[model samples]
Target chain A: MSHIHIDIRKKTYPARDGSGEHLAIRDLHFELAAGEFVCLVGPSGCGKTTLLNLIAGLDRHFEGSIRADEGAATLRIAYMFQNPRLLPWRTVRENIQLALPKGEGREWVDHLLEVMGLTASQNQYPQRLSLGMSRRVALVRAFAIRPSLLLMDEPLVSVDAPTARRIRQLLVRVWQERPHSVLFVTHDLREAIALADRLIFLSAPPTALLHEVTVDIPRGEREDETAVEAFRRRLIGEHQQIRDLL
Target chain B: MRSLLYHPISSFLLFLAFWQGLAVILASPALPAPQAVFQVLYQEIRSGNLPFHLGVTLARLAVSFVLAMSLGTAIGIFLGRHEKLDRFFDHWLVIFLNVPALVTVILCYVWFGLGEIAAIAAVVVNKLPNVVVILREGARTLDRDLLEMAEAYRFGRLKTLLHVIWPQLFPFLIGAARTGIALIWKIILLVELLGRSNGMGYQLHLFFQMFDVAGILAYTIAFVAVIQSIEALVLKPLDVRAKRWRR
Candidate 1:
């Protein structure tokens, strides 16, 4: 069964200077299956973040409906934005604890902090943390609730290469253990190939899905950067639209 | 501990020496020696007069400070969140902010008939606008990204306010509070001097009538000591705790 179904016929923003409306997304319809890892690859300004916002219920003015298997109201959703977005005044542990539902235990928070190798720094504030460490705290916060559907908007972008790789590995490890449907948005094709079971390509604004590619390699083998790069090159060569859009 | 205490203590001694030297040079009744002021302060304390007046003034300050802060914070947040309400009330805030404390006190007494309610209301009227202005700026500058995070995580209203909104507003609240306490106590004194039968302000007025400079100095010293202690004991600790999360 699909974990969540998103059918946004149109989404638009009014021009600030009294001009006509600017179309953001048109005819973007897709369903995320339970436990499936899907990466949305799109060009910059393609409204990927806006689409995620729609699904996360942050921006509810878009057209059409998003239905989950458990009904929209009951389905738990967690979002990780591009920036760390951790509360600076809150300690790392307190930040994660804030995300948990009432009556939930702190054990899950401790376990996630341990998985992220942030157990020692959990009492420290976000301002004292390096960007990589803060991002790890943000990831721990996202997983603290064990949401049924997780939406990430280029969460690993702009990090140093080694830290980004380490974060991706931690992300995959946690996702494997928790087993949830994830809609990951990224501009990096190689990163998506390494992380996603299926890659959905999107065009520039008034964004619509252009193509879908399935990574045939086994999950364990995807850890090899050379193999992921080779697969990305082959996929780009095969799909002229993917090459043009990217 | 020594480093922290040494400078302030030495500075205070330096101030006393200067005052003593100036008193000896001038040798006027209007400018009494620090020792003479201390003697008067001791006498008032011994007779129970200083404590009673100080307690009464402090009670008025507490009531007015709390009322202004709570009311101003709620109104400020409401106005900040709603552009239309802010626009509507902007002129009123400006008028109240600029009106003199003395005018408000006299008006409250004239209108409400020289009662405790009038004195406190006068102080609240004078201090509320400042708190509102401070907290309005705070509410306006709240982080949008964190608010979105709260919404995505389903924090709900109360949780969002406590964990997310409150921390962001804390610095502003502190700003409002520090200024509020300072402003409220001064206005309370003015209100008491204008109409009330008792309090440090009324006693100061009585001393002024008799040209009892030593008595005025003693009362002023006592009040300043109390205010400084509050800042040292209550506000400084709060500020340190708030900034503990910062690098």
Candidate 2:
């Protein structure tokens, strides 16, 4: 498990053609304790992905100090991109194997295949699998590393509702088994509420943290449809701005 | 096996019939009957001269092809990944690509003297540019998403290249290899003809001086048959193995 501390004084992207600049983030700050599940919710095009990129160390143009406390081993961060970036040339099992730490065995990959409901499709190439199946493989690949921090960038955005729900449940199941610090970005408030222990909401572009909502509902009570509906309703009623963004 | 034999055998017979018809029509030494050329082919094979010359040509082709392809792919990948380097070296690729094979052979012969090194060097220089151009496009178009995935997962450099980068680059490498062999073998003949006293091209040159059209045709047919066998046996099988992942 890893605790991530993010402090951004300001971050501005220069204009490509020498016009004005784009203020992607300004004075935004947040932190995550070890094994905490946090969901970042924001309006569309509000630099949610940019924030994840900064935390994941993919984008360094930002003026920020993002630190992850090193545990026994150096921190291993696995990112599940918005797209299911499985290599088309590799099989599902091989794709997961690509993310295994050095000297890690194939038994973990077999277990991941079982967990992802991909036993039959383990030998299949990415081109032949459905998008949901591909996403599951990507998730399996991410978790196979037994990461200290996992950054998910709208992983279920383009899937249908049923598949998205199933994948979300699969994600929760895997996380519960081996808890890791997770920062999931999503524009869907319902998804954010359903998945995260704590929800941090952000405003439009030049994003600054608006609010942090802790889910009081227990883990066992979370899967009930009526309970989720009640919690979502209460959340929207309490945060009118979140309802407005929705 | 029957299906495979049917088309090629039928095509071979059809070609022979056309050749026989032309021989009968022309009734000239320039155009010998297919059977007459085959007779010379059989005699040369039995005498071992044809096989020896063919083996020499094959050896030269192998060395030059290996040199050209390895150098070309390395340079192409280097240029493709580095945009500034690509810009600096783009004009050089153009120059080498446009230079004629015959001219290159003659220049090598003039500069390095009439030797095996000159002949092989000419063949390599002529073929290298084409491989470079093809692989440059391959390297340029490598998927950024997959690369980011590799980095995020902390894949080591060798693993990333083998499991991620090499698979993406395989099709381009295959393309370069196929065309390199086709173009380089023909150029090797010119190199051998101009400089070397051995190989199929040199033998063909000797037959030309004697005005022996049947001997020339026999050598040509033998060389072509060897190339076709390599394509069918080696290249096609390798292509299928590399691309088996594709649906």
Q: List-wise, what DockQ does each model earn?
A: 0.93, 0.79
> In order, what are the TM-scores of chain A for the candidates?
0.97, 0.94
Error of 2 at A26 (Å): 2.2
Deviation in Å, model 2, residue A209 alpha carbon: 1.7
Write down the worst ten-residue block by lDDT for model 1 chain A. Answer: A1-10
Off by over 4 Å in 1: B1-6
Candidate 1 local lDDT, B1-247, one digit each (tens): 7786578788899899999999999999999999999999999999999999999999998888889999999998988889899999999999999999989998999999999999999999999999899889989988999999999998999999999889888889888888777788788778888898899999999999999999999999999899888888988789778877787
Query: Candidate 1 chain B TM?
Result: 0.96
**lDDT minimum window of 10 residues, candidate 2 chain B:** B1-10
TM-score of 1: 0.96
User: What is model 1's interface RMSD?
Assistant: 0.6
Instruction: Spell out the clash pairs found in candidate 1.
Output: none
Candidate 2's error at B229, in angstroms? 1.5
- The lDDT for every candidate, in the order shown, is 0.91, 0.89
Error of 2 at A233 (Å): 3.2
